[model samples]
Target: MICPRCAASLTGKQRSGRICAHCGKRFALDPAVHGKGMHDIRIRGIAERATDHGRLKITLTQLWYLSRTRNYAWAEQDPQGVPAGIRWLVALPVAVALLLCAVLTDGVLAFVAGAAGCVVLVVASAMRHRPGRPPRSQIIPSEETFRQLMTGAWSTAYGRLPKGVVDDARPVPRPRGASRSRASAPLSRPTAVILCTDRVAALFLTANDIPGRLGAVLLEAAGTEGTAGRSDIVTGALKELAEYRSALPVVVLHDADPLGVLLAPLIRAAQPDRVVVDAGLPVSAARGKQGVVRLARHNRFADAEQLRTVAGLPEADAKWLADGFWSPIAAVPPRLLESIVVRAVERALAAPPPGPRHAHTNGFLTWPQAPQTPHARDTGRPGAGTSKREGTSSA
Candidate 1:
């Protein structure tokens, strides 16, 4: 057990007194709420325990299935820490016996006996409880699970759920005609465009004023055609991009998943001449992050197009895809992701002009220089021409 505030190891004295000796912070302990050793638990420790326990249970269930069915090949190759050699050693003798019985009994009786044996083995494996193992009813603390428990506990203690959680649950009432307000004026052409793989991320950026801050246009790569009236938002963004004076930098932001990795390539394919920079939640980022939630291999959310796109990826990325693990864009904290985007945009803004051959190779025209503001156009100095004359006027 450790102090949640300072990560100092908790002592027996502190545990008994309900105080963190290092941080001098007090934490409550309720036998009903925390169960045994309540004082020893940390908030993060609870979540880690829960997640580990869940994964362990799932692995055990899979192993039981493999063991009961006597699937030697799959069982031996199982990657979830199953005891492969033990499984193989147990299964081989049974398989050999089944074959020998068929030879001895001339097949018919052997089939009946094999079927009975299989059923008994499956049932027994499922029902058997090892004496030393913890019971299934034991609670495993997890961050998400603990958070939910704390929500209920807080409600009981304070007569209401936490204000943040309650507010998040309530629908935010948008002003009537808000959609019309968004569509009323044509958007100014931006210096760059950011394409997000999902609407949730795009909306998050918009809500945080990222687009205005970066002087970039934000667009969702998918679900535009399916969002009913919101399709106009996509159309308008595209229109602004098409009308931009320069070949504005087109940056692709996505999850560390297969689909996200392929977004830059997809955009490049659509407009072969444009310079598309992949601002990533790359596979490396996911691999490095301890807090990242790695989804199982063979995600249902992945489509055939995404699968095809990843086929030509580098060895490591391709292997990540084959392993069926992906980290979502949402896994990275919003602030961190925003900072990444800002840095990428700044780099693009500072880049020198692309070479003529590179820019014109695929029949795309060279990018025009950025358009000057109306004030700059008028006097060649922004806001200089519109100054009002005071008592002493300019000659």
Candidate 2:
């Protein structure tokens, strides 16, 4: 391998560290290229775990899709995480009702008997399904937070060079009049980059434009794809965070409000003594709606903004708080938001700071899509209720 910076021949041993010795350029590596299979398995396992429990989140739009096309078994199951007891209970009443129907109908009038049994079965099942658990709210960290984490330094930051090094503003040709040799070959800018966004759609949009990088996590999506809290997975993701080898930077970009504010703290909580920067500043303290306003009222609230003097939005957009579009979204917490923030914050420090405007629209916000129907989870699905097993189990 050759150092992307100084064009020096990089021995395998020297390549072990994620920097070029000749030019002191740091880099981020692709987790996908490093070991696609292993990561796939981990992701699949997490997805399965989410499916088994009611914790898995599927948007109503997706549920409608699955209902129309996928297997019936899948439709009944919750992707994030579902309770085991409910599975058995749902099966129990159907069996009992059929047995009672058979005994009372003298085992004749099979069709009519079956219909009656099903009616009873449906009613009992409805009764069993009554209010399992309160729904958990989906939380999304805001955008523009990448700067927030990097406002100061902590541990080292890593990232991959943007693709298209061939025609890049900085070309990769042998030094003028230099002899041709492996030592003279320039390093390739990595194919893709990583970033963190609380909203999956917004992350996709960012990743979509980056030549080749794909957003690894979708915080608002269904199943374990977005959920956090698996130590092994989190550790692996963190390990990936710690080890990339591109001269370019990885970043954790999130909103400037409450959720984004939490990104730095969350990363520090994961790895202490590490300094992270706050990428974008909140437009002002008065612009503090969502968690900002909510937290401001709290006893620990600091950095109160003087709305009177704050200028227009940070870079390009309007005021961060007054904009009903982004403010409400700043409140919700999405599952994948944390990891996305971590990735974006790391990237922002290495790359140019992002412009002020965010990419998401009103439709992208979670609360608006919340279950208008009774008992819908804020994540946009049915709420979980207490298990019959937890209540008075009737044998």
Candidate 3:
């Protein structure tokens, strides 16, 4: 194992103390790292190493003063200067000089000069103590650099590149109580197919009973199966859609990041005629929401491709994505995600057949019911509401 604190290679003996001989720093091995998986540990280690040297240090005097002070708002307010009394003493003479000049000169010209002097003083005072740029270590790692380090560290620790979670080529298990007879079995097409960005999101949704409630099939778009060039599950899903000729909606549930937003578009390319809705975490939902995990800087082949594919997105969104801001679908409150999925499924199920003009409008589509016609609104027969006397007179 490599010492996370020093980045030095460690032998089996050194692993026992979890200490780095080079840096003389001791690290407590987090049980979660080994318990969960090595991938997470690697990511954390990379982030730590990237920032450890870059962290800014404060002197003891500064720390003591900051702790003792009540009025000082470090980083928020400017540092206190010469006492207010001293400032006033200096400003009084300047003010008196300005007043004398104003009285001696044209009032308008004097006023303008006085205003300019005040502006300069304020600007100089404000600029004098402005904070400098934070250390690079304090700044979050860039997506590219973070990914490189994560990948390199993983390779060094595991002797191989990390793989996607859903890379297995095996077929998905059939639902329980499916028909036994192959020929006579009824075709079971889901109302909507839910595509996840990764395996964790898929597993989370599965654990939360999303499939049972929504009757949707969950798929990982960048799963190992897709990356390995043997996407049996995806192929099977596309085949099923073709075979059933079902107008089933495809819902993409992904992270609230650049790559996730593009999942719907990728799925749409496969089924151009089908409706594809982004049920994934949206930017709005991600904001102020807690438990949002960041995407690992390093990406597998599919992930890199996804980033490339979304290049044509609007400048702001593209920049945000490129900067590596992401929140996984699991970060969303499970109940909220479940509710969103339920509503999406219900809407899809209730949607009317597409019209000629709406055939291509299924991309980024919503499920809104068409307005009811006046004839359809009538509850009884055409003449049923008429009075009996009126009916008899008409007869």
Q: Among these predicted structures, which one has the highest TM-score?
A: 1
Segments in model 3 whose C-alpha atoms lie over 4 Å from true places: 1-189, 224-244, 287-292, 295-314, 353-356, 359-395
Measured by lDDT, the strongest candidate is 1
Better of 2 and 3 by lDDT: 3
Give the true-structure RMSD of model 1: 20.7
Residue-pair clashes per candidate, as listed? 6, 77, 5
What is the alpha-carbon lDDT for the whole of candidate 2? 0.31
Candidates 2 and 3 compared by TM-score, better number = 3
Q: Scored by CA lDDT, what does every candidate get?
A: 0.45, 0.31, 0.44
Model 2 Cα lDDT, one tens digit per residue, 125-176 = 4543232222121211111221121121101322311111111112233323
For model 3, the local distance difference test gives 0.44
lDDT order of candidates, top first: 1, 3, 2
lDDT of 1: 0.45
Cα lDDT tens digits for candidate 1, 277-385: 6676767545543333344333334444455554245565655554555555643444455667787777666654446555422111122122121110111221122
lDDT of 3 by residue, 199-270 (tens): 554654543345654666665555332234334445544654565344777666666655566556655567
